[model samples]
Target: MAVASNYLLDTGPLSILCSFPLNASPYIYAILQYTKITLADSVIIEAGRGKIWRIVSPLFKTGEIESTTTPKEPEILDLSYGNDLGLGERSTIKSAMQMGLTAIIDDRDAFVVANRFAVHPIGFQDWMVMLSREVNLPTKMAIEIVRSSANQFPKMFLAHILKLLSE
Candidate 1:
């Protein structure tokens, strides 16, 4: 497996990115590696419908995001604990681990599993921070939108980042 110095997006983050309609934008560009974000093959197929496809399909044609499949070799990252993760999440994490890449996933169970293996997991809240702070989005709006969406993400995690963003 090739080492991915890019953020590997999972289905959840991809969906939320598509769904978040901010200023007539899909809001996916806030991801720092937006130009380099990739989707596992399964995730691409999974996200190949609805709002996500509309936003990301053009990017695929423009070569902004890449589509990759699970490697046959270099099957790293023990999957025993990732049973709760869906196929896309599992492959995303596994692929990230093998390639030493950070995974952009939003599932709580997947986060816990990624933590056990020391793989960097960037969830929705983290994306907000990246948007407001790193990506230089409107901090106030990013915080409000992200904080209010706590029900869709991890509340505590969202609170932590919001606090940090406020500081």
Candidate 2:
């Protein structure tokens, strides 16, 4: 089996996935095939009792979604003062910084903040494409999934991603 790549998931990416059809199992499963997704405690709290939580709850129980606590380290304190980021985003970025993991953050502001901190961030759209190309998920299905969540992404950004997928 191929070793899975680990990624820190911020609430933005989870929210985007939550916007998918009732049960996001298929897509989630596809991702889990080659990626280990970790969610910080703050991310769970931020998700709350919503569609996102509902979908992730089972995964958490099944160990498909790993849970982690945000360290009270200096990195978190630095993030706290850097931007108007939410608890989840800050925790995710800080965790990524300490762990040397890439973060999946779809929000533009959070993405920028992560970059500024030298925590490499992947947008959800780009992540989808990466899974398709690197993990050998069907390209058509990947594009379909991206289109399904089109409304959640910015128009220009979505268009650009679509063009990349086409190429």
Candidate 3:
């Protein structure tokens, strides 16, 4: 059997995945069940004593989740200079490129950087659409999850999601 494509998440996507209200956003859970979800150790450090880890720790404990570290890629970070962003975004993008995995990043600068490196970058709204389509999540429930998490999403992205939900 063919393995599914792996998705490497940054702090933003990981936080959103773990932030859904209890009992809602089952699509998030379903996606986790179906995909090889990974997080860079830098992202975990950035999440830092938050609810994201609390809700997802059981999965990690059960070996359903995986974490990795990118060491240091000075060349990649050097290319990202003058962007005025931190190393976390740089590292996330670099790690994804190095591993040839899709990356989930919500920050605009980070998204741009990832795109520049030719690494596919997706945001929360993209996840909503993807999860809905790939896992057969009900459109209504996916919309609700996107709407409820709108505040955590970029405005442009939220608008696009609303449009998709409306259609």
Worst 10 residues of 3 by lDDT: 22-31
**lDDT winner between candidates 1 and 2:** 2
Candidate lDDT scores, in order, read 0.71, 0.79, 0.72
Displacement of the residue 97 alpha carbon in candidate 3, Å: 0.6
TM-score of each: 0.77, 0.86, 0.81
Return the TM-score for candidate 3, rounded to 2 decimals. 0.81
Off by over 4 Å in 3: 1-4, 22-30, 78-83, 165-167
Question: What would the per-residue lDDT of candidate 3 be over residues 110-130, giving only the tens digit for each residue?
Answer: 788777778889886887687
Model 2 spans with C-alpha error above 4 angstroms: 1-3, 22-26, 75-83
Where is the poorest 10-residue window by lDDT in model 2?
21-30
Q: Candidates 1 and 2: which is better by TM-score? A: 2
What's the lDDT for residue 35 in model 1? 30
Best by TM-score: 2
| lDDT for predicted candidate 1 compared with the true structure | 0.71
